[model samples]
Target: MKKNLFIGALTLTAAPIFAQQAVQRPNIIFIMSDDHASQAISAYGHPLSKLAPTPNIDRIAKNGAQFWNNYCANSLSGPSRASILTGKHSHKNGYLANWNKEFDGSQQTLPKILQENGYETAIIGKWHLISEPTGFDHWMILDGQGDYNNPDFITDNDTVQYFGYVTDLITTFTKQWLQTRDRDRPFFLMMHHKAPHRNWVPAERHYNLYEETEFPVPENYFDEYEGRFAAKNQEMNIYRDMYEGHDLKMVTGIDSDTLLFDPWPDAFINTLTPYEKKRFFEAYRSRNNDYYNTDLTEKEIALWKLQRYLQDYLATIKSVDESVGQILDFLEQSGLDENTIVIYTSDQGFYTGEHGWFDKRFMYEESFQMPMVMQFKGEIKPGTQVHGLTQNIDFAPTFLDFCGIKIPEDMQGESFREMVVSGSTPEDWRQSLYYHYYEYPGIHSVRAHYGVKTDRYKLIYFYDEDIWELFDLENDPTEMKNIFGEEGKENITEELKKELSRLQKLYEVPGI
Candidate 1:
């Protein structure tokens, strides 16, 4: 009886220690959608949010924190992705633009740090960095600007082509990877999607979605680009740039693949299986027929193109939303939601007819800002809104902070984990953000420029054109007017310039 009593006492004493040992680092799943705009997301409260709601994506914001003013370090894909992974700007990371550049994967990245600290890391889906990913135990990424239908995935051993829509296929592969991953160690999965990018292609399930639906045109859809030399010189205008053959899936009457205006060749269309090709032609047949018949003015053509573009864009995003739901459901089923962090953001916010543009390159708010919503399961308070300035460069440090790993000294961004928990702006948070875009003499013709953005003002220096643009965001939220040399704003411009100089020095950017 005395031995039994002593054994019971020992078991009771070890219970708390055993429980403490069971506590593990939280798992993280970062979901990124290419060119997803905050304005298009239902959580941001844009007008179209009601027309096309993203309920699953909004659930993250509802359950955790919604960052209202999340901006990108550089408003380009490869640069932004590199910034997120390396916690540094393009100058430091060396992925300045999508054209003629490949990400140097040997450097210390977020995944590498996590993997070093006993975490299993994986990345699946659109990786536009042009180099094979490093530091991931398993990775499968799409080829450059991967095909929307039946995309080809570049895996470790083989470049396998998968059928079905790109978004759905990515989700399927992600779920499969999750099932087969080593269950002993914590995991960090990056589920990237290529939907809603240029030449938007909707899944067959959503091919005819938004038919006869008219999304309201942006207030600045017909912007004249007055007073802004860079804006006037840009080559991304929706009316002039979005080609029927390339963007709208409308083929020219000729069979020649090298037509002057055909942006996408017929060979790409042939990439679809026969059944998919039949469905694709059938879905767009009436629209193409109507487009050729309709006699419209340039303004009317622009509006027509905007409608078609948005319809396809929103339709493609619908699959992304569904995929979000699937992942969330899987987490709940696997009981991983109790101790995991889920994040949803985009490489960079896209321009959906804002300033009559379809692509993202400029440092304007529509292109410069990224939508970020994170749900840290039980850790974060529900329905929290973080209004402080945050950028993509902070992602790496924040993830490291969550995993209890020491962030590297060379990384430039600070962790926002405190902001997420407190549900309020930090008193010492950054007052301004720096932005740079480097791909000029390339697509869009947007001059390579760097800028600084404060809470109320923005200053952009078009270095290639030697032009400056300043906007009081409070007064001109749409940024329709350039207030650089305006009458009474000399002091504001000077103050912004001083701030810009300070940031350039702080970030160690060259030739400020």
Candidate 2:
């Protein structure tokens, strides 16, 4: 084992309950999506929900506890997932960025510990760790980011290509696993979906969704990147970075005059049948024609692209929402609803036209915070909202705690199961969250920085530029102005710097 694989000093809580006859351990289902922002989900009640409503995803919140303050230690995909599996931050888990090397499968992981504790474990969907999964007794994962049409899944035996929308196929596999799983033993199933990621493509059925309706542009859609060096230098803006052929569904030769940069949709569009391709193109025919034919102002172009972006992005989520309904219905019908825990969350949050950006490499609020909702039928009361601080690292320990297994001493996160179950905040719960983003001088041109976020203030240090920024979140919720040198903030600035250092030391972030 890479670390302490068992609890040593911790007292045994509820005796290993899975071994009991009458009261078998509850089944665990963790459902995740890639780059799915909370703003897109209607349950959170953000502005985007006005047009793109997600009823099924909201059902999870309606029937269970919703974490209003959940944050991801790192905002990127691979790093966030690694943190969840290992119950540690990026620096400790060693998978700090999407481009980082394969995950160390030898490390002590949640699935391995669960399997050791007599639970059946499986992961079906996007597993971008780059290493073959070790702990899962059964795992069928996607190849790379995975294709929207006819995605390939690497299973225990072989890599098989499944022809269908990626979301439905993954959900189909999850339901299959649930149906065939041995009811005698409890199971841990990770139903991950690849939807609403970059180069957002909607299913054929939803291609024309929100086409007639125009989405309101973000107030700061034309952000001038005033004082922040990192914000001014990023390459993720909607007007410039979004690909002509890849993102907007406007083909270079047919739909526009510009050359394609990432032409992402081309990778799998050919896999579709001729009929499928014809219908797909037909759906975007009007939109493409209008863009190629019209000439608009600079801001009008940005607004035009934003409309195209939101339509496709939100439509992709429609299928994932439907998938949730399918699974929830399955559980309720199969009698598993009484003794199962179903969690709905994303790998991390992404930007949906916020700050005129598209990617999620920043420590800004849009990318820094993630959405989390769990439905444990008997345990969590419906509509219960948790305001306490939590992060992705808490996932592993919470799972272990729920199943009556001792959390390994090496895990950095504590179980919020009790805090959530009790439906109240604890007296001495976490006060501040520590965040670090290391992937800089790479994609999106975001600067390397780390910071500490309490309820009201955020102090960030852009180490590479030797620049510091302070945002009083209560007064400056938008984080538009940096108040580092402003008068009357010296005491708060010092306190925040001290808090940042304390968190770095507490979380054991590599360097002092």
Candidate 3:
């Protein structure tokens, strides 16, 4: 596998200066999961991570570079994925919101470019863009948000149902492709996962994990949504919005409020084998019965629900972490570890009880920040930490640049390959990031909003109601208080707005 080495510049001091050689491009494996938050990842140092550690994910960061200021252009799965594929924002890629949107496959994308440049490209996992994947020699994707158990996959030929946990099946397909691929050319693989998403369902092995553990409640669990009107009206709160039977898995109550929500729990469990179902119920039935039978106060119920939710969610991630270790192990065993660049990231971040919420759509710190860790063995220094800002849009350009392919002029993202290699941010790197969310009149009832964030301050504008909020992130990392119009802060607010305008103009986005 080391035969596909750099074409020129023998030293690995920085990104290689390579020509148009078909045989020299490095293989890249992009491992992305749905809605896996940075806080849950142990590498990012959130206290919750100590409770549920992810050693495999932390390995990538320890072995190479971890970006502390990584963000997504939009916080939803589809939009963030589109931006990553095209190195452009949501509006440019034309997949604004999730529903009623199909990715325009004919457009230029990273996979297409890599395929054109003598790389055997394949994607085997969650593709929620609602269109036949283009630009890859092979693709096998989930059928929209994908069932966690015995899921169906849409291949180039036909849709086939696989009998196993979704994470394991996806990992199997990825390894199978690698094993039987045309090895003359370097390979680029996108191994995506659907675990740890909504209605969290763990693999059979992880069903009993965290059963006895009680996760500490977030300090802002009882946040009153003071001063921020948009926060007050959201429908994503864990206590307020999660369905009783579907989310909490407490499925045997008489009241309508205690029933499961549509399209989960029942849909997923009914597909399992009787043997599997018996094991599943054996793991959960006693706890569910205890919850439904015992009398509890309102606060107790909320705490119980939050604890249960974390247990299930974290359990789902355990399988994903295992899948990552498998891929890393394969690379080492097959001698591909030297040249293959492996990345671990999520489509977007989620709120793991931050602001007492479960879903993501807001420009708040919890949901807006995405986790990005990469391993390039000799090129990137171990323990490298990048404080400079990077966004999802930068992914396509960075991959192209690393592969010695010319990035298209139309891409709105800048490559940060050299910065990662040198373990230092260049002085000219981006100082701030821009974010937008347009899924309003939609799920979670979060209003359509856009915002800008520098190292210290953040400014958000909810367009529907002409609302504006500002936070001094340096002073308030949790973003609990909105300081939009406080005295002596007028200068910071005005400057953030100006920077927001500059970014919008530079990106060719129309001012809101």
Candidate 4:
């Protein structure tokens, strides 16, 4: 009888430990915003960013660590997101560019690994990856750059259009899923936003938020493209190439004067006096319709470009911030805040009139950097800033690390959990980061190039041109001065070449 009582006591003692271990698994909520740049958010301290402050995005940084040097392996939407999911570069994953490439769902991903470890996974929002999202228990995604107003969502069963704005609708589904999902198991939810993308449409509520003020321009807005041949021919120029078709058109009625002018009949205009009709024709001409007939003199026209750009961009971001607040609020109300890991980031950085360019696909700092911030309530130390070299490829391993799942050997990135949890970055980490930009002569006239970025210097090789460009980042942060092929930097250039070659071979890149 004594033996039986002792056995029961032993079992009771072990029960609490087992229950504690089971409950320790954290819920992960990864929020990704399309085409969002660190420059747009006030948290990053861009001089022109006060126009639309991303307070909700700032909230994540305020509560946890914001990575100062986070970057994407490739600087396009689909390719960058693919790297995040697979923890592999575009070349390794077979998704180098945006054309005709689909994410193969059969490969190992965070969702699949988390699901295998007994977590309920649901992805609600923009899944730009071409394949049907595999390994997700429940998924409702947008069908290829979903509309801002009355967007359509593709569910596991069928495609359905939901009324209201895309950002609000995505958040509605996220909240609904949180309420309906199984409560016994932890959840991994991806709330992706399609706002602040091309054609920059803002919701009705944010339409008039920044209408009165003019946004300031970056110092490099009028870059002359002196040393860089690729910068001379980019397609994202606002003044030269932005059109009224497709994404840029406003839903509101376009002004008649903005339309292409048709030559008036000879008989009709002969009767009108030259002086009386001079003002009328001038007002109605397409050339004068560029700035909505505002008195933007030549000097102001330069400033007006940045103003119009930010007004539309910030307006879209305003709605995105509101949606982020809603998600954070829902987590708090559901008592999931303590156990949930919230991450806010963009697929890639964007240009806000920097270097006279707007789109990505260059290894330049503006296009290469991505805003990465995360908050794990109890697991990660609050208000930590990590300066370690982290990439989108590191995201998959980090997620798996949080869930205590085994990271597959094939994955290319190492988990940064130790850096986040302990608040101490590792020394002698990656001395340099490998970069590649494949989309060439497509949208941005940037040539296909691969490069290496060390702490102080950068070396780029434009394969098509067979030209190499090197920049001393410490001396010229704006990348204005190219020290490559210059006198007295030969030894430094040679050393960087050897380091770049070593990295290419270490990463198993072919034909280094």
lDDT by residue (159-228, candidate 1, tens digit) is 9888778999999999999899876578899999998887788888888988678998999898898999
- Can you write out model 4's per-residue Cα lDDT over 1-512, one digit (the tens) per residue? 99968875776586866446547998899999999888888888886677678888888888888888888898998888888878988877878888746888888788888888878998998988888999899999998877776667999899997767788898889999999987657888888899788767677666557767667777777788788766675677765555432323321223442223213222122323465235334432333345565666755755565566677788888888899889898888978888889999999999888876677888888889898889989777778888888889899999999888999988888898888777777885676788888887676566888999888899989888887889998998888777889999999899999988987877788755
lDDT of 3: 0.88
Structural similarity to truth (TM-score) of each candidate: 0.94, 0.94, 0.94, 0.88
Candidate 1 overall Cα lDDT vs. reference?
A: 0.88
- Weakest 10 consecutive residues of candidate 4 by summed lDDT: 259-268
Error of 2 at 97 (Å): 1.1
What is each predicted model's overall lDDT from 0 to 1? Answer: 0.88, 0.86, 0.88, 0.79
Lowest-lDDT window of 10 residues in candidate 2? 4-13
Pairs in clash, predicted candidate 4: none
Q: Taking the tens digit of each residue's C-alpha lDDT, what string does model 3 give over 1-512?
A: 36446532343334333223434678999999998999889998888778999999999999899989899999998999899999999878888889745999999999998988888889999999999899889999999999899999998899898999999999999999989998667889999999889889899899878888888788998899999999999999899899866777766553222336635654576768888877776778767777867899999988898998999999999999999999999999998888889999999889889788899999998889889999998889999998889999999999998888999999999999988998888999999998889998898999999989999989999988999999988889889899988999889888999999999998888655
Residue 481, model 4: Cα distance from true site in angstroms: 1.9
